[model samples]
Target: MASSQRSRSSTLFCAFLTLLNDRLSESLIFPLLPFLLASFSNDGRIIGLLAGSYALAQFGFTPLIGALSDHYGRKPVIAGCVAGSVLGLGLFALTLSIDWASVAWVSGSSLPLGLLFLGRLIDGVSGGTAATASAVLADITPPERRAKAFGLIGVAFGLGFILGPAMGGLLGRINVMLPLLIAVAIAVLNLLLVVGVLPETHPPQARLPLPRKRDLQPFSPLARVLRDPRVRRLCSAFFLFFLGFSGFTAVLVLYFKQAFDWGPGLAGAAFLVVGVVATVVQGGLIGPLVKRLGEWRLSLAGLGFVIAGCLLIAVAAPATAKVLVFSGVALLALGTGLVTPCLRALVSRRLNDAGQGAALGSLQGLQSLAGFIGPPLAGLVYETISWKSPFWLGITLMAGVVLLVAGGLPGQAGPRAEVT
Candidate 1:
């Protein structure tokens, strides 16, 4: 039994490393994207479209991937997704190379834009790795320890946010395509780690069969999840929360450029501050807080932090206060760090082992839907109204979400071992 426990611990550690690498690969592009697109057209609308395209593809495919993970297994699905990301990153870098080699060709035609979109679309379609990773955690962890387990994933994200954008920004200063190539390399490394070190957590007896034609409908998993009132309420809250957060993130790099005359490195540095704060909150604070406040209350507190952060950021842009901007981002990160793992723990606690993958997948799908809409809307508002408009909009939507969660969610203390 001691040896078995040691093996499980080792596997979980490997899983954590895999998740960290996966997140790094995903986030490496964000800080560089605004600069990359600006070289093409300097159009915020186009930037928004390119950013949203990834989420649009993710929105369609996340639930499908989640259901597939349930039917097949986590290890294979995760490995496949990482492999896909490697291909997508390679394509993205190739397009950039082509555009640089023949600037006139890029200027004369839409081929570069098409290639960019296609690359992002490919990555987005396989973006279910996070949800699948969560399912693996659920499979391995007991209910009572799940919150802390999820918090560990948040730590991985925090570390990724710190490293990915900062590295991307620093490398982008050298050459824009450097980050893309690096991300591709990281994806390849992640794929190798997943295949070599990660074991299949979901036993064959526990796995679901492949979906039927009707069950495979794009909206079918969503509809099925919505049938449960509790899950539906959580999903609604998740959607609203991300709707605001995603929009803010979508325009953040552009906002930095316009407001402070910053470049990718400065934007990345700001994100690094956020990541540092988030790492502290999610890594150090969540477990004890969940023990005291419960997931629902912690989520409420997180919303409150987010509201303040958004307002501060909106004010900072107009005032050009560097301190206020960083402070606000730190707060935003803190809130998100707390909210994410707690919400996942709450949702996981509400479901049995049988439904973990599907339920979490649906939750992630809602987030992707928010991502799909938020970036485009933010870009439009930024282009037409002001640089600060998206942040203000985020504040308003988050306020509404506060009310939604307060009214709709039940008082669940935390996960219990025998929830089912």
Candidate 2:
């Protein structure tokens, strides 16, 4: 049994590494997105659409992938997704190499732009690996250790953002296509790691039967999830939190560029700051805080911090206050770091092994919905209203999240009682 448990740990570690690589590839594009899109078109709306397109695909497909994972197995789903990512990245690199102006176009964008969108769409569709990974973690971990275990996901994000953006910045200086190619290589490496190191967590006995035609319908899982009051409340709060967070993230690079006249390298450095703060909070502080504060209280406190950070960021543009901006980002990162893992743990605890993948997949689906909506909405606001508008929007949404979480979570138990 001890040896079996050790093997499970090794498998989980491999999953963590795969997640880290995925995040790394994803983050590498964030710092460079504004510049890349600017080369094609100067409109913020177009940029927003490009970003939203990725999330839109993820929002549509992640639940399906998650359900498929539950019906099949973790390893195959993860491997296939990573393989898709590699192809997507390679296609993205190819787009960058093409000269769009040389080709005649009668429509909205050049062929290269269409190819770029296609690549992003492919990547987004396959991005369900994160949800699948979370389900795997849920399968292996008990409720008592879940917050800590889920925090490992945050650790992966932190590490990925820390390294990815910085590397992207440096590589963008050499050539814009270099980062995308590197991301492809990383995806290939991740595929190899999954094939070689990871084992199937979802056994045949544990697998859900293949879905029927109605069950396979696109929105069916979401409808089923919303029907449950507990899940509905949890998912509602999660949606709001993600909406606010996504708005902040979608505009962050643009915010730095507009507010401080920072380039990609400087913008990347700012992301690195966020990653470091998040890493510390999620990797180090979460387990103890969950032990002491309970997921509910911690989630509320996190929302409060996020709200405060948004307010600070909303005002940071007036005076070009670097300290205020960085402080706000740090607070935002810390808050999200605490909230994400705890919320995931809470959601996982609510479900049993059989439904873990679908439940978490639905959770990720909502997050992707937020990602789809938030970036475009924020970009529109930024272009039409003001640079600070998105932050103000974030503040409002996060304030609502605080109320939602406070009222929704159980109030009778203490931290230890609730979690352990």
Candidate 3:
């Protein structure tokens, strides 16, 4: 019994590390994306598409990977996926190093560009590590203790999320690709850590049968979740919130770089501010705020702040207006921080015990789907429509979320979660 407990503890540590790596890799690359894609093409459309590819791939593959892990067990699935991430990040770094201009049969930047997209796609394909890590936690933890265990996952994620952009922005000064290489190293380290230390928490005898055909589809469960009238409206609010958030953020760095001539350091600082605010709000302030304000009112306030932030950023200029953008970012971070957890909790409260899994699962699927679609669409609008258009679009989207959240909510529903 002691040995079994030690094994669970060891595997749980590894799982936490995997989740940290996921957040680190994501946040690290975010600020550097505009600069990275500048090598292939300076076009906003291309930049947006490249940034969106990772999420797009993640959305399509994580469900399948989770199912595979359920059937095959956790350690092998994690090891393989981390290995794939290592390959993908390495490919991207290698492609960046190549001199496509001098190489024969390269046909200009096309080959390099193709390689870059391939790298992101491959990494996205293996983006199941975080999902699998969550499964590991569930396997080792009891129902009563699972919430505390899951909170640890958030801490790991928060640390990585705040640190990644700061590191990328700061380290990027040495070389633009330095953060990318560091991300590659982290992936490799995670792979080694899993292979050497992580145990298979899902025992074979206890494992369920293979996944059904429909179960493998990432968003397949959303259909059933949305059919419930109780959650349907909240579901729409959730999807639109993410769609607007991810859409604008995908192209935000590019916007600042082009608009105000911001460099990696400045852009990274901007992301850092966002990270700090998001962490502070979601990490420390949210529970108290939710207790006092309740989810419905807090969610509406969050949406309002986001809309105002978008307006500020939309009107920001190059010189004195830099403050406006950062201010806007702080507001966005605060609002999103409040909304992310609060809104999800709002969805959860509507569902009974039997429906919890399906409801939460659909919310995640919508978040991923929004990430997949938002960036490219924002980029296209940013290029063709106007530089200020994407923020306006974000404003519109979030406004819709506000209306949806407030539309049918009753006064009695607001304080129910707080009392619980």
Candidate 4:
């Protein structure tokens, strides 16, 4: 019995490490984006297009990969994705090498953009890790300890964010490609670890077939999913929440630069506070808070914090006051951390079947819609009127979310977990 427990613990530990590795490699690209943009033609629209394309690709692919995981089992899907990510990162790092060896001094600034989009698309298509990992956690953990299992996964992600961006920023200062190379190495290491150490979570006997992979229109599944009232409500609330949150995040660096004339390192540090706050709140406080207040109340608390954070941003003066700006971000993180798990749990419980991969994939597809719309909207807001416009809009959205939740918006109807 003791040996069995030890093996389970070891498996969880390795899974956590793999999750961290994936997150770190994925985020390394963000800090280098502006640098890459500078090297290219300094077109804001083009940059926005590139960012949106990454989001669109993720939106388009995560669900498909996730659904596929249900039929094929988790280990194979996750390993393949990690291996593919390593290849993608290698191509990203080698972008400049192609031009470097040429006799002609032709600029190769477009390579990063192309590689980034393609890499993100592949990663999106390959992101069965979360679905598989979540299923693995469910399989290993007793029902009473499930929240703890998910919370630990959140901790892994938070810890990765805490370190990933800072490292990416520091590495960016050395050379833009350096961070990409590090990401590639980490991915390679992650693949090896998974292949050598990880055991199969979903054995052949436990496997089930997934829905047929129809090449449907982008918004079709989203619309179909949203047609269910419960999913509609959750997605509506989530969309509003992310619309606000992503908008603010998209413009945060610009706000710092414009309002305080700060540098990239400091901007990176500000976001670091966000990751820390998110980690602490989600990992340490969420379980207790959810147990005490239940999902609805906890979600309200999160929405309230988001509103407050948006208001702070709207009124922010001299954004370079690192402490103050970071304080707002911390609040944002705190609120988001409180709410996300509840939102996700609601979904998880709703769909309480062996088909976690499909459900989560659908959820991710919904989540990615924010990525497509939020950043470009924020950029437009910043360009048209003021950098603070997005914050004001976020505040308004959060206010609506709060009011809706407070009004018993979801209502005590069908199982809250089904459509999540």
Candidate 5:
């Protein structure tokens, strides 16, 4: 029994590091995008394209990665993806090392920019790190404990998001390539860890290989999974929840900059507060909260907090109240911390072991989809309406998400909750 527990602990630690490495790759590069692109083109539109490409690639590839993990095994897929991440980051760093404009033969900013897109695409496709890590957690943990377990992902996510930019901002001062180099080193470490230390949680007895090549098609797998009525409803709430959350965050920095005249230093600091609150809540508080409130009630309660937080931010924009902005963002962080893990737990609790990777992969896919669409749509409204428009839009969308989660969930909760 002691050995079993130790193994689980070891697996969880490895999974945590894997997820942290995945998240840091993106977040570490996020703030540096403008600086990285400034040499080629300072067009604001180019930044959006560069940023959006990552989500687009993740949307298309993560489900495939998840299914592959189910078939081949978690360790290999994770290692390969992490290797891909290292390659991606290394390529980006290499591009930054050379001055693209001086090389005459490199026509129309094709080489550097093309490689940048390729790198993000590779990393984004490799974004299955979180989905597969969740699968490994499911493989080991009991259902009752899974929600609390998923809090590890949130903690890793918060830490990576906060620490990445902090490191980027500081390292970028010495050299632009420093953070990318750091990310490369981290990815290499993850690859080595997965290859050497992480055990195969999904043994041969548990493996489910897809019979046909078409089974690997990302959307088809998604369609097949969501065909389950109960899973479909839960997934809807998940999608809507993220749609609003991503929508607001997509425009958040713009709101901070245009509305409040804040620089990246102040804006990044604001995110730091958000990360701290999220880490504390998801890390320290979720286990007990999930135990007492249960996943259902906890998810709804978290949604309530998110709604209130969005309202505060919307109000803050017009009032120019720095205190309110900080307060609102902190609330957003807290609510997100609660909602993310709980909702994930709820979906996880519904699915059996065999489908964990596929379903969770689908969840990750929806998240990437929401991320891809939310920004452009929110940006459009922000352009047409006002700086505060994304918040208002988010608040409206989030209200609907709350209803979906609250109303739809109870009916779908089967007497014993079996696969349909």
Candidate 6:
């Protein structure tokens, strides 16, 4: 019994290690943005394109990966994806250094635009990120413990962000290429570790052909999984919530730096504040809160807090408003952390084998859709109006989400509670 328990612990830890590596890739890149922009002499539109491209890849590819995981055993697909990520990051690092060798190696100069797209494409398609992690969680953890398992995943993510930006910022001061190189090394190591330690979650007998357009025609999958009205409500809630959240994230650093005349270090610190608050809320508060308030009510309350936080951002005074800005962003982070787990739990609880990945992938797809559209939209709004415009728009959208979830969720709950 003890050996069995230890084995389980080892597996969970391995899964977390991989997840942490994945998040490190995300968090480390943020602090390098200014360097990337200034060095490239890229305009704001191009910067937003870069930001949106990551999401575009994730959004475009995740569902396909999810379906593939379902059809194939999770192990091979995941391991391959991890290796792909290593290669992608390695190439990214190499590209930066290649500037010393020749301009041809960079993303866009002289080279075909197709090759430039391919770099982001590989990063997006090959990471085997959430899909693999989610499948691993499903394979390893009991249903009752899934929420806790996922919360721990969020904790890993938070810790990654906590360390990633600080490390990246410090390293970025040395050279713009430093963080990318570090990310590449970590990705390589993580790939090796995952292949060495992790077992296959799905077996070869279960493998299926990759999903086609006809198979996942949105309405077909949506109808299959979204039978429970609650699922629909949750999806709607997720859509709006992410739309607002993505818009805010897309703009916050630029807004702060411009409005307050802040440096990268200060902006990174503010990001740290968000990560700390989120870590506390998701890791520390969520499990107990779920026990007391129930997932549904907890989500609604979280939404309200998010709305209020955005409202506060709308009124914040630039430069001098550090206290208000941090406070509001902290609240926003807390609210989002609190809601995300419970809502994900709700979705996981509702789905059966037939629609599991598709459903989750759809939710992820919606979030990605937000990512694809949100940043550019925010950039446009910022250009046309003010940096503050995104926050105000987010506040309004979040308020609508709060209302929709409150009203629509109850009607959907009765049927969904039976899916499990």
**Every model's TM-score:** 0.84, 0.83, 0.95, 0.82, 0.78, 0.82
Tens digit of lDDT per residue, candidate 6, span 1-420?
998787677667767878888888878876566455454533344545566777887766666677778887777777878887877666655554555325445545534333434565688778566558767887878899887788667777888978887777677667767777888888887777778877776667766777677765444554554465647867877877887787777667677666776666666677777778888887678878887777777777888888778777778877447888778888898889877777777777666777676687677677777777777777777777777888888888888877766664453544234222
Those runs of model 3 whose alpha carbons end farther than 4 Å from true positions after fitting are: 1-9, 410-420
Error of 2 at 330 (Å): 0.6
Candidate 3, number of clashes: 0
lDDT of each: 0.80, 0.79, 0.87, 0.69, 0.76, 0.72
Q: Kindly indicate the candidate among 4 and 6 with the higher lDDT.
A: 6
Give the C-alpha lDDT of model 1: 0.80
Give the lowest summed-lDDT range of ten residues in model 4. Answer: 411-420
Q: Which stretches of candidate 6 lie over 4 Å from their true place?
A: 1-13, 70-72, 97-117, 137-152, 196-201, 205-213, 216-230, 345-358, 408-420
- Model 2 scores a C-alpha lDDT of 0.79
- The best candidate in terms of TM-score: 3
Number of clashes recorded per candidate: 0, 0, 0, 5, 0, 2
For residues 1-420, write the lDDT of model 2, one tens digit per residue: 998978887888887988898799988887888766665765556667778888998877765787789899998999988888888888887777766666667244667678888998998889888878888898888899998788778778878989988888888778766777788888888888889878888889999977676765556766777666556767788888888788767877777776777777777777778888888887678889988778877887888888888888778754666778778888898889888877777777777898776777677677778888888888898899988888888888888877776665543333343455
**Residue pairs in steric clash, candidate 5?**
none
Give RMSD (Å) of candidate 3 vs. truth.
Answer: 2.0
lDDT (tens digit, per residue) of candidate 3 on 1-420: 999888878887899889999899988988988898776777778877887898888888877898889889999999999999999999999998777777878855477888889999999999999889999999889999999999877898888878998999999888999999999999999999999999888999977777777778876687777777888888988989999999899889999889889999989998899889988987789989887888888888999999989999999988755789889999999899988988899888887999898789888888988887888889999999998888999999998998888776433354444333
Candidate 1 ranges with C-alpha deviation above 4 Å: 1-14, 70-75, 100-106, 133-152, 195-207, 224-234, 317-319, 342-360, 408-420
Considering every candidate listed, which one attains the maximal lDDT?
3
TM-score of model number 6: 0.82
TM-score of 1: 0.84
TM-score for candidate 5 = 0.78
lDDT by residue (tens digit), candidate 5, 391-410: 88888887887777767454
